[model samples]
Target: MPNAAPAPGQQPAAPLLGIGQVLARLTTEFPDLTPSKLRFLEERGLVHPARTPSGYRKFSQNDLSRLKLILTMQRDCYLPLAVIKDYLADVDAGLNPPMPGAALPGGASILQTGRRLSREELTREAGATPMLVQDAFSASVITPAETYGEDSLIVLKALVELQRSGIEPRHLRGFRQAAERELGLIESALMPVARRRDPSSRVKAAELAVEIAGQLEVVRSSLIRSALSRIVP
Candidate 1:
């Protein structure tokens, strides 16, 4: 496995890890991650791991850190690729710019905050009640989990605010259905690569799905804005 952080007294001349090694390091946190997904991220210039003479990928410590940040933003913040790419551009340039939709430092904040959180801890951090959390799971706003991820906290917070405005979890069921429809569209688009039983093909398929999801988010946002413009003012 790739060590995203160097061990003390580790050689400065250490060789970087291959794609499989990087996957081994990241898969526990990003279970759905694949080689294709990593390549897709590279295509968008989110993280540029080095290539060997034979064109094999090699990931460095910095590359792993950047990838961890990218996945965190996607899974936790629900950000689009464009936004994450922009954030990565800043971080790569040595800037500590504020993370969009986060109260913490850009990319660096995740170092302090680990992935897992208990249900009570989640509710308290999101400023939500126990009842609201139960309601959210019951309405299928978020899948039930023994321990919630940071994304759950973010969603719960948003639900709390919506509830105050008379927009309860039940009111957002359509959003979940729409998400499933979008996921189906992504799956259909990746069918060619996804059908291949080889490891490389499987990786490529995962990456393609993420790229399509980003474009869909842009379209979804545009439609929402267009509708709001007609209904208001």
Candidate 2:
């Protein structure tokens, strides 16, 4: 099928790939991916491939990159589609948004470089001892993974610094409990949206969950800052 021409005032470019071609390129990396999944992602507003004259979906190079990034985040990071959509929105607006759970540097877009480090590499890069990593794992501070992402490295590095202050992972075990409590609060708040159970409502519920989590984080940080101020003075 011939690709559609660029719209008025739009720059003409290379030919776009049909759905089968897109799948051919991506299936090796994401075997579980299928046409329905791609359509679902589009419905969720994560990626918008152009429509051909006969209404076939044709993906551009940019769309392919975006799909790769989305799939990678879901597969590797276990991030929800809603969170991924928010991150992609920031990227589309030309903002260098940090990865969903990681405070990476502005220039380090995971979309540009899908970096996955082995266990040994993660420990070495974070300058963390194996014991510390084990403790963190035991404390549920970091989930065990064969290959860790940048977020894991960031967490390990922070733990290493905290260890010097005599704050071991065991001391922060309650953090996981606190997180679960906050998650419970989110789930409770989303009950209204969740009751609908339709596709659109499901998407809305997911997005609302992210928004609620962000607000909870703000409150949590404020409380911590308030507590620290009393101790420092």
Candidate 3:
């Protein structure tokens, strides 16, 4: 994590953020944001909203902007929190986010901003039960998130439909393996840039990993289901 900001030039200290203000600001964008979840992000080093004399957090406008960027990447891009943390690290250092677009070196567009969804909203929209969603995580099909993004909801929704046809979360455990293999490929491909330790490159590496993994999942699931169909009644 970055070092704490120098005490604002010794000027009069700014007001701290109470729970309600923090909730009110973040809730509009991250509807599932709770005090626990915010604390979790802080614990992970993703955000460092300043603390007041009473220890209440006081998020500056910059803090709010950074939070928006992080949530956008998570929900829209399906990036794991670790990767998102790396990207934000770049931003904090005044470096551009590494992703597809003219902003970074790679010509890929995979790092575009995206919308996110809350867990409850995702379950309801995807017509999935909470148990099934939890099972996905338990089976290593999906990771836990403070708020699931749209892609996650879409995947869960599709899985729910598949479950109706007798496919279980355990059946998709291979998906995790297939995904790891694809990530291995992307990592190798990006090693030249990734080895430099540039925050932008790291972000790019992460974005590429997610994009390829998503594609690999689609193909692997389709091929397996198709092959099974021939033997099944």
Candidate 4:
């Protein structure tokens, strides 16, 4: 459960860290973190650090932990801030909600433990051959990278399974085209937000893009399921 706010007329607990100290502690893990980004997260209501007498922000231990979880989810899971905010709301309410983008409840915490893998390690871990990985790259299914993250590993593993059903990476080339079309739709939807020249607007636009993509996924999955039902019946 999350820490409760102090009652009226009560001061927050001692030993809170200022924004600079918090940055010092977290910058190594999150190299892109900046004071403005921290402020942006606060503005998004992901963290509610207490205020000092002079109106400065002071983060408690709980605030620091929450920030870490939020950042980890963003970095590892690529989840939208809205989704993460909803998941954290459940946690604060004392519910054991499943992590977003995870396959199952109680599967893993939002904090990922896996490191990026080289091409060889990626194929080995996915039980796929180098040829298949190359095909995925050729088909634009997976971006060519010197080191692959968990998302690439998951895609390669799925491709390996699909291969057993005689579906090769080349057979899925249309998926890349479909993704490009969906991206076009997202970009169109974000045009108004993108027209703004402010940094916060850019942040909002990015989050909105992910949320739109998630909605598109839901529609795409439903269409697939509907099509499958006709064939299976």
- RMSD per candidate (Å) reads 12.7, 13.6, 18.7, 13.2
Output the number of the lDDT-best candidate. 4
Kindly list the per-residue Cα lDDT of model 3 for residues 1-233, writing each as its tens digit: 98567686766545556667878988876665677656656766888888878787778767777777766676556566666776777877899855522233354344444346788888889899999999998888878988776568768988998899999998999878866777678778768867878665665566555544545555667898999999894
TM-score of 4: 0.56
lDDT of 1 by residue, 1-233 (tens): 87476578885665699999999999998887889778878876788899899999999998898899888777666566776776777877899967765756565554245467888889899898888888899889988877887668779989999989998898888888989999889988999888899975765565566668866766777899999999995
List the global CA lDDT of all models: 0.80, 0.83, 0.72, 0.85
- TM per candidate comes to 0.56, 0.54, 0.42, 0.56
Residue pairs clashing in model 4 are none
Among all windows of 10 consecutive residues in model 3, the one with the lowest summed lDDT is 100-109
Q: Would you give me the overall lDDT of model 4?
A: 0.85
What order do candidates take by lDDT, descending? 4, 2, 1, 3
| lDDT (tens digit, per residue) of candidate 2 on 172-230 | 99999999999899999989989996875675565567546755765777899999999
Q: Model 2: which ten-residue window has the lowest total lDDT?
A: 103-112
Worst window of 10 by summed lDDT in candidate 4: 105-114
Between 2 and 4, whose lDDT is larger? 4
lDDT of 1 at 224: 92
lDDT of 2: 0.83
Q: Model 4, range 67-173, lDDT digits (tens) per residue?
A: 99988777666677776898899999999987776644467544353367999999999999999999999999999987887778989999999999999999999
